[model samples]
Target chain A: MDIIVSKDLKKKFKLKHGQRVNNNGVISNEIVVLDGFDLKIKKGEFLVLVGPSGSGKSVFLDIVGGLSTPTSGVVYLDDKIVEAPSAKTGYVFQQYALFPWRTALSNIEFGLESRGVPPEERVKTARELLALFGLSDFEDRFPYQLSGGMQQRVAIARALATKPEVLLMDEPFAALDAQTREILQNELIRIWEGTDTTVIFVTHSIDEAVFLADRVAVVTARPGKIKDIIEIDLPRPRDGDIRSRCEFATNRHKVWDALKAEVNKAQQDWKLAPAFAS
Target chain B: MRLLTVLPKSRVAQREKIISLALGGSVILLFLIGWEILFQSKIVNPLFISAPSRVVLAGITIIKDGTLLHHLGISAREFALGYGAAVVVGFPIGIILGWFKLARATFGPFIAAMQATPRIALMPLFIIWFGLGMTSKIIIVLLSAIFPLIVNLQVAMGTIDADLVQVARSYGATRWQIFRTIALPTSVPFLITGLRLAAGRGLLGVIVAEVFGGAEGIGYMIQYAGSTFQTDKVFAGVLVVAVTGITLDVVLDRLGRHFGKWRSEAAVH
Candidate 1:
């Protein structure tokens, strides 16, 4: 069963400025954050998108999540066109954007609230989810009181509380320290294994893509287009030992090679501009 | 153990306290000395400016007569009516304008124009419409106070961080939920500030309207004293108005500070 399909997804943004700008204002040059991006994910597949910083990976995930409308394209989830944000698609932002005003439990309960889940049921489910994330003790604390890693866990809990068919994450662990990122990565794998939800994780870390993804999609810079898809034939419940294995190194290198050209191009592009040169 | 560790640091804090007290004391002493010299020289008519001593005596006399209490009560009642009306009308209108684009487009410019037009100049018209009763005074106060309420709320709503709104929408919040949970709470600090400003303006409006034509209130007393050339009484009335305004401002400021603390803690996150 197919969970997500993107066909020739294209997006362009027009940069406009100035007063009484009667003109359509020059295209300034279209920024194609996504161009002819195509991908398909099987139901329950853990798909990771890995590329350089400006590779438009986040934009692609946003398109699939329906947080943003594509300039021109179609995204189908569970055979329905993903036109706008809905309970079927859950997005966990990179910044762990938990509502500052809410306690951890309340933040997790937010998605349930949105879905019209009754208060008693929501509280029970949120508490259960927080416990699953080892955050049961911290439920009463505000987001500010929790560390960065804990906040991200709360964010993940909030996303999963809605029980979506697919989870879209954009650099969810990029802000965390290496140790915390590793631990959360394992937790994510564990959670994904436990549920039927299809996961589309976007990240810049090669180890993360290798460890968590069933299939890794590498993307090119700027007008991001999928360069290649590498399927990890590794066994389930991947842990730290996988990193030391030759298979892991080979897959990592394969991804690195697929991404190296785009990375170089992006760096060259940055160098030609004064902003990065300084 | 903690108390022992905090003692040396506490001395530094105490030194700051002592310096502040000394500065305050010296300033008050200098002011009293200057007032005493002015009274002795009789540079200005003692009756007109009123020596500080005579002003104190007059305050005592008014208190004894019970007229001072009556005048204060009347003024307070008028201020409460005016300010309360302004808040009641202004808050909801602000929320509507802030929430609905059409409301903003339709009424925003008109509100701005009303705010720009000085309310003092409208006192005569209000008197004509409502007459020289408390109704006219309240209307003037409402006019003076409502503008800041609307303007602050509109600005607060307009400037809410877009990310927070996006987060709310992503959660599938209904329009009302978004308004109640996010927009309303976020706009509160600005609303409180506007309310405090409106309180002062409302007081000003009450006094101005009363001075123009009113049977009671502190402003009426000031007018009576001015006409009779009983300068001490005029000074006494002015003092009462000044003290009232300052006290109201201080109270509102404390209230604003209390509410503002929540936003600051949110910012720390």
Candidate 2:
């Protein structure tokens, strides 16, 4: 059964007249971020959405995670309409949004605390996840005390604390250095393959989408919807060495080919409004 | 020299601290000596500015007679009550104003107007209404201190990282839960800053109110001494006020450091 489904999802941001839209002075009464966006994810499937900068991939992910509501249409999770955030879906943001004041252990336990999980069980779960992420020793350390990679690990652990059925990640490794990003990507895959969670990850990098996804969904430019869904015919238990394989190159090329026009269209939109091009 | 050379690495830190203390003390010592010499040689009129020796003598006399302690107790009580009231009152209001746009829009102009009005000038009105007692003085301090706390906490709440709140929301945290966990903890550093500003301003408020009308407090003592041309007594009172302000500030600074250890550590990272 499909764990997540969005039926004709549309989101439009209304702006007041003469309101500062972007750095560019392009004024519009409404900016449509998503229009008739639809996707269906099978249970435990690894789906990655690749798109250009302003293609509303993150916006759609937000809608799926229940962090946002679409202007029109409905999102169904487990055949139930999703209207608000719950323990059903876990969200990993682009920024490591770990609370600065909380230590690694407490941060991982945040979702559990919200769910009113008993303190002893919460501690056990957090420690187990911490150990899983190689962060057991740093559980007492605050976010600022941890490296960016470690912080991201804690953020993921925090999101997974409630053991949600679906994990929605929005460019979770975009801020990391290249080496850290690659290492984390491998670690993410390793950790995720062990779970039965349906993953919908969004990114701009075709390499990332091809590597992490079972199926890569390429989204169109503004008023974004699914352009193409490319199947990654790679084997399971994928690791860092997958990137060196010819199959990896072929799938990467296919995803990029599907995305190239949208990327150009998005860039043209930016060029027309030069302020946002930056 | 040999003992110093043989000192351990940990003792070197102790040595550095001692050296710094000595360096700081030397400047005050030189200033005191210069002041004493200037007065003794009659370069400056002793009546205009009393020497450190005379100020000490006057301080000793006041202490022996118990007046200094009495005034200090009264002033301390006023400061404590007023500052405490400001925090109790302003903090929640500030959070509300920051959290809700409607509340901020409604109260923002009034807060701005109150803050802009010179609160010192209202002392006479307070005295007339509440009389020449601790009530008037306490109100003055509260008036001066509350605004900064309100303004700062509001700013802290207003400028909270939207991403953090979103993360909390995505975890199924309720609005109140988000406020309790994310909003309040994030505002700690700002609250401390606001408290510090309030402390300085509250001290000024209390002193000025006492100077204008009170029968007790260091401000009153200083005013009475000045009226009688007792320069030594006036200097001693001024010294006490200055020391109290410094001591309050230092205590608040230590509190800030304790609560905001996470923030300071962020800068290190």
Per-candidate clash tally: 0, 0
Residues B179-257, model 1: lDDT tens digits: 8777877787788789878988988888888899988989998888789887778778888998888988788777776
Best by TM-score, which number?
A: 2
What CAPRI grade goes to candidate 1? acceptable
What TM-score goes with each of the models?
A: 0.85, 0.92
Name the lDDT value of residue A19 in candidate 1: 17
Judged by lDDT against the true structure, how good is candidate 2?
0.88
Runs with alpha carbons beyond 4 Å of true place in candidate 2: A19-28, A272-278, B1-24, B266-269
Ten-residue stretch with the least lDDT total in model 2 chain A:
A269-278
lDDT agreement with native, every candidate: 0.81, 0.88
TM-score of only chain B in every candidate structure? 0.88, 0.91
- Give DockQ: model 1: 0.23
DockQ of each: 0.23, 0.44
Q: In candidate 2, what are the lDDT values of residues A10-80, reduced to their tens digit?
A: 98876554544442355665677789899988999999999887778888888888888999999899999
